[model samples]
Target: MSLLQNVSSPADLKGLSAPQVEALAQEIRDFLVESVSKTGGHLGPNLGVVELTLAMHRVFDSPHDTLVFDTGHQAYVHKLLTGRHDFSALKKQGGLSGYPSRAESEHDVVENSHASTSLSWAEGIAAARRLSGERDRHTVAVIGDGALTGGMAWEALNNIAVDKDLPLTIVVNDNERSYAPTIGGISHHLASLRATRRYEKVLDWGRETLTRTPVVGAAMYETLHGVKKGLKDIVAPQEGMFEDLGIKYLGPINGHDTPALEEALTLARDFGGPVIVHAITEKGRGYAPAASDIDGDQWHGIGKFNPETGLPFEVSGRIWTDEFNEEMVRLGAERPDLVAITAAMLIPVGLDGFAAAYPDRVFDVGIAEQHAVTMASGLAFAGMHPVVAVYATFLNRAFDQLLMDCALHKQGVTFVLDRAGITGSDGPSHNGMWDMTISSIVPGLQLAAPRDGEQVKQQLREAVDVDDAPTVVRFPKGDVGESITAQRQDGSLDVLLDVQGNPEVLIVGVGAMCSLALTAADKLVAQGHSTMVVDPRWVLPISDDLLRLASQAQHVVVIEDNLVTGGIGASLRSALQEDDQWQPVHTFGVPKRFLEHASRGQVLEEVGLTADVVSTTMLDRLGPTASGRSD
Candidate 1:
């Protein structure tokens, strides 16, 4: 039997010898590649943390000590150690989640998938524990070097530094990568300390030589310790950044070495105060394909693939991201003032091509979304039109920045939100359902949801042209299917299906839901209800054209992939009410709740966003009139 098979909980790890633990690490790595290759989850980040996790389990009593993981993508090993070994249906409906789940295990805490939040969580937990007089229970936050790029981690660090009594151990898993290679000043600082051989030897020499001189030896070591920060920098450029903050710093220890990680962790745990244990490790250490992937394309967040060949089972078609990618490069060539910014995801949001084309113009602001948004405002102030590309869910982090800094000042910044709505498998935290609600409240911010690849390109150009207010262009996660042509155009509206006379129902589809709206319109028309379908490409600000069209119909049906409350439909309803035009308005969308992990289609169906569900509900609401009875 394998070592992994024998292990169930963190307690099971304690019984194993050092060599046995090393064998278990290999077993875990092999299991990860095999299982994740079939199931498709985070494979690279988890592979690197096997030994570090094992050491953590051995040193700290979890569920009591309170171990927290930043971003939680790397917590798959932690899950396996804590008794969740089933990987057959990972990220599918009713299956294990991609990140740390509170419902799945007690060992898991701070299940938020966003980067650089673990430190703040650890600080709060540690401070509360100290106030409650629970000194025995330790709090360890395992944060990546990539996550440290976020401003929140440093904000938490600044607070954690002053409080010397908190029993908190911060494990800086300096694997030199997050979504991409760790960027900015903090990353460069960590990179300088990666070469620790000389520093390690110098410490060994000091320990052996200084302590041998009896009473004076101890005093001599103490005398040298006063300027140790400078002395250490002379030897290896360790300027004692953490020590300057008043937190105890330890190790440039090998993260893969089980015994070394255990030793460093034990010291940090028993330190009786906040400590930073900086361990050097590699991402995708055991797997050749993953480790060699410098661009972080296939391995970081993967799809189903062959285990041996490391090739994907299916090559996805040109997606919504590809539309943006080509347009960005073209925009770069046409406009000299055009610049782009991303919050650490240089590649995921399709900015890599733009960044390469206009290297100086593209700014990768790390995982600091708030900083990226405000920084775009700064760029706009300098006469450069900045396009901020980021995942829709992450845009939530910068709402204040987008509102106060950008919109308040009338900065002409364009935010291109990728994976805009109902991103399944990654779970509720990842869904981009709240963008429309939040962006709608921003006074001058114009929001657009593109229906197809052509609209994605066309709308993006239109958004960049607006030089007085913040604009948002959102698109979904998958392939932008065939373009749906309109029968005719009415102002900014694309009338897909215009019934000859005054229609009983006006179906307004927002973004990708336009196709689904057309499907429902067919169903309604088949039942003898006069249905007119239109795509208000830009849904925010409640267009006068849309209000007029809604007034013409007996019932207005608005469909979107965003939350029902305070969405485009809600805004339209309020506008019509203010104009004193009362018509029965029906809205169908994702309900205000945390949707569980499932396929996008499954979630849409469950939430009654599908054509059959929506059409049936609309028919019931309309009742058996002359229009419906004609069928």
Candidate 2:
């Protein structure tokens, strides 16, 4: 039987010898390459953590002893060990989640894939364990060096340091990249520790000269440790950041070596106080293609691809990301003071081109979204336009900074939120559905959701023009669909289609939902309903002209891709009602719930955002329709 086949649980792994364990690691790597290549998910981070995960399972008991993975992307190996071998429907509807899910098993804790929250979670759990007198149980937090850049991790570390007796093991999986390489000073210190050549030389010299003899030489070396300590002090004193923080620092250990990892983990678990096991892992470890990738992320996440060639089987159309990236270069050329800021994801968020064109203007602020926004506010205050680009989901971290620092101060910071509105495949926390709702609550913030590539370019230009307060440009993932032109441009609102008849249904489309609006309009026309489709370029604070048009119709249907509550549709409905245009207004959008990990189309269909579904719902509500051409 295959090594993996016999392993249903971590206990199954206990029976295996070192050679068999090594064989299992290879099998797991092969399994991941084959499975992830077919289904498409996080590959690089998983590949790096095989042995570290094995060591963790061997030394510390899961469930009985909590194991929290910061940013959960590295938990694939843990999943495999805990009996979830099937990867057929990975990241699909009714399938295994891409990140850790509590719904999957008791072994999986914290479904979050967001960077730098595990440490805080671990601290709380350990504190609870102490209060309950469950001191025998352990709490281990495995976080990447990249996650250390976030302020929350530092905050947790500070508190954990103070306790001194809290039995928490902080495993810093230093691969030196979050999405792209981590920027700033903390990364530099980790880099120095990773290159522990000076410390190694002192130890190696002692091993060769003094320790070669019998017990007498060893005893002499221990008692007369001046030479060793003197050399180490002058060369490289091993007092690193962890030591400075009053936490025991144990490694620069070989993260791939299972035996060494087990030893390091065992030491940390037994060390009473909070300890940091500095495991030096190579990102995209065994996979040659992943290891050699030069661009940002280095196959951190991928679609189905050829395992050997590491090339995608299908070519994707120009996505929303491409349009924004192209426009950024053009904008940079036009405005020299226009700068771009990224929170350690320059490539993934599509700011690589802008960074390449104007290197000085681009600031890669590690995995610190809060820092990125505040820094952007500072840049904006100094007579410069700063465009802060990040994933829509991650923008939640900078909410306070964006609201208080930028909006309150009336700073001209343009936030470009990539992957907006129910971005599927990465699970609940990854979906960008909440950006619109969050923006609506921020006063003086103008939110723009562009429909197509052309509109994206136009909206970006418009967002950059706002000299006071903050402006936001958000768009969903995947291809920027076919352009739909306005039949009649009315200021900020564009009338995409209009039919002359007795006032009936007015469909208001927001951003990419314009195509769906057109489909519904056409279908409503086939029935005997006079339908008009209007696309409001600026979704928030619905235009006065659109409100006037809403009064012309008997009823209004606001179609959007954001949440049903606190979104553009909700605001529009209130405005129409307050104006005493009290028609039965229907709002179609994503319901207030976390979306599942599935294809974008699949999730949209599930939420009733498709054209057929929307049309049928509209027709049913309008009652019996007589056959007549309204358009």
Question: Model 2: per-residue lDDT, tens digit, 158-243?
Answer: 88889978989889998888777776899999888877744344335445644555643223343434533422232233347777
Q: Which stretches in model 2 have alpha-carbon errors above 4 Å?
A: 197-238, 296-298, 501-503, 626-631
Q: How many clashes does each candidate structure show, in the order listed?
A: 0, 0
Would you estimate the TM-scores of all the predictions?
0.94, 0.93
lDDT comparing candidate 1 with the true structure = 0.88
Span of ten consecutive residues with least summed lDDT in model 1: 229-238
Residue 622, candidate 2: alpha-carbon lDDT: 85
Among residues 3 or more apart in sequence or in different chains, the pairs in candidate 1 whose N, CA or C atoms overlap within 3 Å are none
- Distance from true location, Cα of 466 in model 1, Å: 0.6
Candidate 2: lDDT of 552?
83
